[model samples]
Target: MIRHIVFFRARDRADVGRVLEGLSILKTIPHSSRLEVTLNGKVDQLGNDVDVVVYGEFTDAAALAAYKAHPTYQESIDRVRPLRDVRMAADYEVTVD
Candidate 1:
């Protein structure tokens, strides 16, 4: 299993909603065991710049690759890129006994 995590910072705080909405399109891509888009809920934190987070769980590397290549996912990326200032991603394999 692979856990894919992405953190995004919007160009403007008001654009966060649009970014989240665009990212939701990833849910339609196949081979995703679980997918979620969430807003960062930081309270009174200093230097917290992340505005949104995308969490995805895939069966393996192939599934993750497929998800990234899907047209719908590409569309979402195109739409959200303009609204975001920064994006970071991480992928890790999870072992289940």
Candidate 2:
């Protein structure tokens, strides 16, 4: 399985809601086995730079690719890019015995 995780910080703290609203569109896409958008919660004692989080699980690399290829993915980017201060993403394969 492929695990997809993305973190984002808004350019302005007040715009965090807008960023979340923008990312909400991704839920409409049907490619991933599971997908979610959430707030950072900022519970860590050291780092709270990230404001938004996107987490997804895909059956395989191809599924992950398809999720990215989905048109809503671009819409999410177009809407969030301008309001975001930073964006970070990581994808890794998960082995389930």
Q: Tens digits of per-residue lDDT for model 2 on 1-97? A: 9999999999999999999999999999998888999998899999999999999999999999899999999999999999999999999999968
Q: What is the C-alpha RMSD of each candidate to the true structure, in Å?
A: 1.3, 0.7
Task: In candidate 1, list every pair of residues with a backbone clash.
Answer: none
lDDT tens per residue, model 1, 50-88: 888899999999999999988998899899999999999
In TM-score terms, which candidate is top?
2
Predicted structure with the largest lDDT when compared to the true one = 2
TM-score of each: 0.93, 0.97
Candidate 2 clashing pairs, residues 3+ apart or interchain: none
Where in model 1 is the C-alpha error above 4 Å? Answer: 43-46
